[model samples]
Target: MSNVTTKKEVNVFIDYLARCEGETALRLNVDADGEVRHYEVKLFEPPRFFEGFLVGRKWYDAYEVCSRICGICSVPHVISGVEATEKAFDIKPGKQTVMLRKLANLSELNMNCIVRIYILGGPDFLGVNSVMDIAANPATLDVVKMALKLKRLGNDLTDFCTGRETHPVGIDVGRMLKLPDKHKIEPLLERLKEAKEDAWKVAEFVASLKVPAYKRRVPLLAIHREDGYALNYGKIKSTSGFEVTPYKHDEYISHKHVKQSNALFYSIGEGQSFMVGPIARVVLSFDQLSPDAQKMARKYWGGPEWFHENMPFSVYAAHAVEYMHTTDEMISILEKLKAGMDESEIMKEKAIPQKGQGFICTEAPRGLLYYTFKFDENGDVQFADIVTPTAHHVHNLEQDLKHLGPSLVGMSEKDATMQVELVARCYDLCCSCSVHCVTIKK
Candidate 1:
């Protein structure tokens, strides 16, 4: 078969595999000129009907219900959901509450990033079929074991803060059910210290790989923070210097509906594309990284290219650096929480439901996750809006493929196919999060 026809065949195979992840479809047509004739990412996960479903529910109900959006991204959904509700009610959670929330976000990041690197994305980069294949191989078995340990730390952190890791309970508006006990926090911090070392090993392994020398000029976007890395905190920062409060998401950022997909894709008012998630966070929030992580980034990437351009290779390094930073940051946080451990349950507040709107954006494992809610005087949800990182990411990934097409055209079929898959997997694309924005057809 000619190389052009083979590359097109691989694109078809990717679309088939995408169904296993979510109801997503991709169509790429390359013209005789070896340029992209057409490209589209269509997501058709069943309509969730979430916004209409929450219409008459109390604000506190959002944390649990919105969490159902995606099993992997539930923690951020819950945290950002509560933040939006708290903003509408004008309530600020106590110190301990905020600390616990931060810990939960870190845990989610660890779990998701590890699975993507060692399992899903691993095979693509290694030219193997799956993590199972890697695990069964004598040469690579030890690598999989190390990855499991890192993923376990994320689950441990989640379990410590919220009695349940997935679809966590006890995080109502203005309330945190109970902080992890001293007993739990003490042991977890110790294990995390060890996990830090293992993370370094994982980082070294990923850094040793040959990263694709791909670059595209899409605008990068992420939440901005001054105190530290943005997680359930900060204002929106885009590569273009466009900054806006979360409330203005609807005003400054806009979404477009394509008949081919169920998800709503976003842009910065002018219909321009932008990338989000780890690459955006790592580049935009570089200064805020801990000293250790900054040193590591310098060691691996060795220059400022990642911060200035959209190089997919930077995504792996960015994820590795953040993985290390989160381990240390969580250790520090656990020590403090352990010292002040108390047996008290979440305090109840008789907050009167105020009539207003609330908006918030937080860094989730995947990238910039956002939420907005409007409430009636009775505190019932009048309307709700959510934009997951995957939705915002679709355009950047497709654009990248367009730029990457020419180089892929004449390569050996297998090499060409793998390169295309590697590029798609680089975003760590989470179709579940993207197609989750679906609604019932009117």
Candidate 2:
């Protein structure tokens, strides 16, 4: 056979292999004028079993139970869940307690940012399969070294602030189990400054990548306040301008059941859709970023327009800005810390037997996380609903993939797969966080 005929047969064979291996494909049908007429992202469910284990647990224990939602994000889950409980009880943790909680959350954000950007996004941008590739690339080795330095800074700060890195044990019902001395906090603040600077440099490097020209106008959802992008608390708002408080989260949000997946499908308002997470935060609070972050953002991207339209390349730059912002916030709080508050000051009153509903909304590193719980007289969980940001953004990921596929229809299969993987990473879709995974078997 001629070369064209042989290549055509090979292509057909590879397509058959893809189908047999159960590889999920994004099929895009493009019209004569190069417009996308139809698109879909084929998603296959990966093995996950955590949501089922959460049913029937006491409200007080939900914090510990839901913490397992993701090993990387356990601290945020635990702290946010506990805060929701406190809100339901109408208890305000003392000033010192609140500050400590903020510190812990900031530490978690810093660590997560490092891992996602340097360890994950870095390799992908450089066309490498993993961090090891970056280490091996002579041109990218400095980037790898800087990422490691920043990661270490996050790990050390987390250990000092929360008493451990992977799973912190400092958070409690009303306060931290223990507090780091001023001496320890002082050095950590210095380390955070260094990490923030290094992260900014890496972000600049990411901005230089040649990203595909993909755009989508999906509505971005996040908590916004007059103050700025609320990290630990605020009202929920969307890119299309819908806004509500945490107490009314259910009114604007709803979940659907998808076959073959335990993950709940999320929708905003009346439409089956996606909401929350990093992209949403960047869209909602682009103006709130610090001057340094804003300058860097513009250097990488012209303005909010680049981020608002679902550009996957924006993830690295946005993550860097958030890391710097969170680091600065942590340092300010540590500087303001005062002595002389007894443990009793930070602890809440004895647990009372009463019916109560509590709601808490915080900016998890991934996106907007919400925890709501109704407790009975015995402090048992009568009703529990935890809406993770990852779950909220799944539909958006699907939508993006669907739109991207048709553009790659004529490309080589391997090139198409790379494009899809890049889109998936844009959402920073942590199947570990969403209790769902997407696998390309072929």
Per-model TM-score on C-alpha atoms: 0.91, 0.84
Instruction: Give per-model CA RMSD.
Output: 3.0, 4.9
Candidates' C-alpha lDDT: 0.75, 0.67
lDDT of 2 by residue, 43-75 (tens): 453544444444556665778777767677777
Q: Flag regions of model 1 displaced more than 4 Å.
A: 1-13, 18-21, 258-263, 307-310, 342-345, 350-352, 412-415, 435-442
Model 1, span 225-295: residue lDDT tens: 88898886678888788877765667767788755443466778577778888878888888887777787
Pick by lDDT: which candidate is best?
1
